[model samples]
Target: MTEGRKMRFAMVCSSNQNRSMEAHTLLKRHGLDVASYGTGAHVKLPGPSLHEPNVYEFGTPYKTMYEELRRKDPDLYKRNGILPMLKRNLAVKNAPQRWQDNAADGIFDVVMTFEERVFDMVIEDMNNREQKLMKAVLIINLEVKDNHEEAAAGAKVALELCKELEATDSWEDTIDDIVAKFEREQERRILYSISFY
Candidate 1:
């Protein structure tokens, strides 16, 4: 077992299809308490053309999307890596979850977003929530590209950050030093703020 109390984490992105799922799988594999979320109104994936994208509601099953995409154009989706991505996502969770819809979700110790806009959305959503518990959560943003390769790399960094946070007994007391050390070692600037749950 780990030394300190396990910190609950949330990985968030625009659609929760690629970046957030990538990080979620990695964190879960390492035995971390974690969940993934999207800030968008719909879960979106690339289509045969840029103008035409496949969009599904927040709770749409990944298996359903996989079957539909494969049936529609197996070769195209396979070539574009969407099939492989869907397979990974299916292994991690049942469906794409929207951040706004999950307000009732119990408090998370950390909420990490993959983009600036998404970071803004998460912060806004948290601010709008009715803070009954008054527990503090650190919301951090580490910009990651939506593509698979970048998502994988970003997930590794996220994993490292989570590890550091997990090692601490009280994150609220040492978060400043922890984030500073991370930014120095990883050579990546991070934007972060503390909000209440």
Candidate 2:
């Protein structure tokens, strides 16, 4: 509700697959202006581990990746639900947009990331913007476990955050309150207010 304009939010993940897409879908469903992107140097996933994914550059079409993945290991991609995620991603964006690319488009009221690595990348990207955005963007780091089940749960949390923002008139203050409330809790939940410059 900053200046009565609808909030524009961004969600980021490593590969632009599970976590970010989940949050993006929920936020968009709520009619919020939102986008999701990855901070990875290359599109990656369906690998032996998170650290090692079949890497491809940003803006590489999802269809091409899907084909390559199928050719490489049909069963592996199918088992990991990679193709479904790829299809969903392609339906939304023509190709993956890196966090820096998304930032160049426009400033977001709140930029939320599902991982600490992405959180750092966002801050760095913001700092490197050619023209400084006068307003403060509350960069939130929500520690989401990167699995299908956890992504769904993270989507719910993302929806909650969007609802909280929708109800408030002050964007930064509401973010502050949400962060403080989360920090006070003992159990696992969204964490914020760490390095939101």
Candidate 3:
């Protein structure tokens, strides 16, 4: 890519609260120029002061994950704090809509949908002339399995789909591996070209 022509990516997930937020953090940490949005509009972006509805319903797992992220890296909070600064720098009041009426006007080089249904919807739209390209990838996260064997099987399938979309890697076998890949590749403009199902 040229100096100004970085590959942009957008990740749309079921709930922006968990997986998508994690993915966003991972991508940015790796130095990829990426953005993430949630299908469920109410999900809050992860941050020190962020709030979410029914947060109590999610319980310990959510809290544990959030705390872990904070403990592992204090910089997430600082990076997230830059969102407001962008508004001031650009003089734009509000960010762009998720689905712009004019698909050609959008900025993402690749658009990924986490759920199968969302992937199908995006495909259907492409068929209906809603999007200009049909290069979207569907990323499916299988049920949490007890062993690496099961997880690897699921990840293999997911990785194949990414490969078909011309993604750089065939699969990210583990969460830690995925996180590490993101952290190590921050200087290059690599998008975490994935969707969840």
> How far off is residue 128 in model 2, in Å?
3.3
Model 2 residue runs over 4 Å out of place are 1-5, 48-52, 182-189, 193-197
- Residue clash pairs of candidate 1: none
Going through the candidates in order, what is the number of backbone clashes in each? 0, 0, 6
Q: What is the C-alpha lDDT profile of model 2 across 16-90, one tens digit per residue? A: 467998788778877889888888777777575767678888888889998888888888888888877887777
Q: What does the lDDT come to for candidate 1?
A: 0.92
Per-residue lDDT tens digits for candidate 3, residues 1-197, read: 11332455555545433333334444555556556544443433454554522222221243443454556554853365323322221231123223323354455545555556555554454456544345443333323232224323433433332333334332333434543554364321222334321
Q: Find the candidate with the highest TM-score and give its number.
A: 1
The 10-residue segment with the lowest total lDDT in model 2 = 188-197
How should the candidates be ordered by lDDT, best one leading?
1, 2, 3
Compared to the true structure, candidate 1 yields what TM-score?
0.97
lDDT tens string, model 1, 52-117? 999999999999999999999999999989999999999998999999988767779999999999
Q: Which model is ahead, 2 or 3, in terms of TM-score?
A: 2
What is the clash count of model 1? Answer: 0
Instruction: Order the candidates by TM-score, highest first.
Output: 1, 2, 3
Q: Of the pair 1 and 2, which is ahead by TM-score? A: 1
Q: State TM-scores per candidate.
A: 0.97, 0.83, 0.38
lDDT of 3 at 121: 53
